[model samples]
Every structure is written in C-alpha cells, then in structure tokens.
Target: MNREEINKLFGVTDEQLDHMAAEYESGKWEGGVGPIVPGRPRIYDEELETISFRLPKSRVNAIDARAKRNGETRSQFLRQAVDDALLANA
Candidate 1:
C-alpha cells in the first residue's frame, strides 16, 4: 500500500510509517520489505495458510509451560511442534 494507506491500516500517522519504512530500508528490522505501493499484488514463493484448532485448557497450560521452559513463545513452540510433526510424518 501507499504511505497513506499503510498508515491507515496500521493506525499510525504518515510520519510513523515513514520512520518505519526508513528503519526497514536501513535493515534495522529483521525481515521482508515493508509496505508496497497501492494496487501491487504481494508475491509469495508459496502461499501460507492459517488454521485454528481447539485444545483443552490443561493442554494449553502444559504447552505454555513447555514453551516457557524452552525459552520460546507459545506460537513459536507450536510452530516447531508442527514442523516436527510434518517431518516425522514425511
């Protein structure tokens, strides 16, 4: 998106977006190019799809504890679990 559109979507001012863009261009942020110009399709090597699943509260607590023990966030732990499962199944 253009600067105005990006700012609107992110709920930031144009100045904020510009600062973010500059930071990204300077490689201060980790990955990917920042906002694209309006009307340009975002290209991907392969598309990623998201899914949601339900687990018991206790199971979620266990996962959170395990993640913390491993010094990872819950999301990172879950992603690692998925990757491991895929590799094992393959």
Candidate 2:
C-alpha cells in the first residue's frame, strides 16, 4: 500500500512510515522485509496462517478474559486450545 493508504489504514503518520521505510531499506529493521508473522517467537515455532471469524461481543470478551488470565494473547490461547482439543480427539 502507498504511504497515504497505509497511514490511513493504520493511523500512522506519513513521517513515521517514511522513517520506518528508510530503516527497512537500510536493513536496520528485521521485521519489515518479509511476510508478517503473528504471535511472539517464544509462542509460535512455525509459520502461521491468518484466519478470522466473527463472534458475539460477549463471547469475544469471555475469550479475551480467559486468555488474559492464562497470560496469553487471544490468538495464542485459541491456538493452544484448538491444538490440544484436536490431539485429544485424535
């Protein structure tokens, strides 16, 4: 996306994006070159696929609360739960 589009989409200033772009071009930023990955390195050992589905606001709040209580982000909590459930069933 162009600078304006990106700025609009992410609410970043054009100046900040330009600075980041310069840093990335200089190879000073490790994260801007490749496909973006979600989750922290400690939590995710492999590439991740992005997925989305809508849930009720209450359900989202419940999930977020559970994840927070477990010291996990929503995505990490969901991923771990799904993996565990699938393995258990298998």
Per-prediction TM-score:
0.48, 0.49
Question: Which structure among the candidates has the greatest lDDT?
Answer: 2
Off by over 4 Å in 1: 1-46
lDDT tens digits, residue span 1-90, model 1: 797787688799977767877877676754375544445464446776778999999999999999999999998799899889999999
Q: Write the per-residue lDDT of candidate 2 for residues 7-50, one digit (tens) a residue.
A: 79988897887888887667676664664345444556676688
Name the TM-score of candidate 2. Answer: 0.49
Task: Assess the local accuracy of residue 18 in candidate 2 as a C-alpha lDDT between 0 and 100.
Answer: 82
Clashes of each: 1, 0
Error of 1 at 58 (Å): 0.2
Q: Residue 85 in candidate 1 has what lDDT?
A: 100
